[model samples]
Target: MTETVLAEVLAELAELDDPKARAVNERHGDDHGVNLGKLRAVAKRLKTQQDLAVQLWQTDDTAARLLALLVCRPRAYDRGDLDLMLRQARAPKVHDWLVNYVVKKSPHAEELRRAWFADPDPVVASAGWALTTERVAKKAAGLDLVGLLDVIEAGMATAPDRLQWAMNHCLAQIGIEHPEHRTRAIAIGERLGVLRDYPTQPGCTSPFAPIWITEMVARQGAAVGRANASPGR
Candidate 1:
């Protein structure tokens, strides 16, 4: 049954191939040659099909791996399985999607984060930081915010590119969500000068932590104001 499902999935992907889209993806370092829109559509149809997802992932096609990230049951795999998958993730796009979509949603995310953070493998370490950034942005109730800030301040300068991006995001989330640390986060951003002068396209917010934090904080304040100004309030 898994083989049959894998065959069907591959057939669908083959039919959905787009040369133009594939070209764009290749330009952006995605050598998959498969259309992402079609992959998402396939994932929606195959949701929660863990056996098929594993089979597709074993095929090692980029689109199939992305589908695996979407459809695989997070609870079915433990840290060992995730570590193996991360080790096999050679493509940047595949590694990123696995981190965001698979690892972040897993029940063992925090456990994996602790282990992966210290991993010498850059991909594993990047995934750890990415998961931490998500937790900081969303549910930071029990996290040691000060310790986290200290780690980011100490390591972000020498971190690899992928890990550095997520670390910067974590710093911004601290400033945006934790008012007590906002001043310190901004100070760290200023000291590091990360993306401080990086050119941004028209209308896009800068990724520089200070600017990112300022915009997020203002946006949050405006949201609160709107909620308070509402008639029901």
Candidate 2:
């Protein structure tokens, strides 16, 4: 059944392959060339097929692995399984999906995040920080906001690029969600120059920590004001 599923997925992927999309993926460091739209479509078709997902992942094809992320059972993945996936993931895009779509949704997310944070491998550490950002964004009640800020302040400047990106996001989330931390987060952003010069697309908020925090805070305030002005608020 897994082989049959894999064959169908590969056939669909081949039929949907676009040279332009493959080139773009390659340029972005995804060597296992595949069009993203087709990959997602394949995943949609194979959704919830855990055994097939594992088989696809073992193939190590970029598109297949992405499909695996969509179909694989997160509850079935233990720390060892996640570790193996992270080690096998060489592309930043792949790592991002694995963390956000797979590990973050797993029961072992917190356990893996704590362990991965201390890992020497940058990819693993990046995943840890990514999970941390999700936790902070959702306002997880037990997170030590001050300790998180301290870590960001102490290591952000010297962190690897991917880890730094996630750390900066965590800092921004803190400023956005916790009004009291807004000023400090902005100060940290200024000190570290996090994504200071990143080129943002038109009509999009800058991802620079200071700008992002300020924008998010303003948006939140506007939302609150709207809520208060409503008839039943």
Report lDDT (Cα) of residue 81, candidate 2. 94
Clashing pairs in 1: none
Candidate 1 weakest lDDT stretch, 10 residues: 29-38
Q: Across residues 1-233, which tens digit of lDDT does each residue of candidate 2 receive?
A: 66886898878766776777778878777765576666777677656888887887898887778878888888888889998899899887788889988888888988998888778887788888888888888846898899999999999999988788888888999988888888999999998897899989998999898999888778888998999999976
**Backbone collision count in every prediction?**
0, 0
Model 1 per-residue lDDT tens digits across residues 51-108: 9878988998887788888888877888888889988887788888888788887788
lDDT of each prediction vs. the true structure? 0.85, 0.84
Q: After superposing candidate 1 on the true structure, give the runs of residues whose Cα lies further than 4 Å from its correct spot.
A: none
As a whole number from 0 to 100, the lDDT of residue 158 in candidate 2 is 92
What is the RMSD of candidate 2?
Answer: 1.7
User: Best candidate per lDDT, number?
Assistant: 1
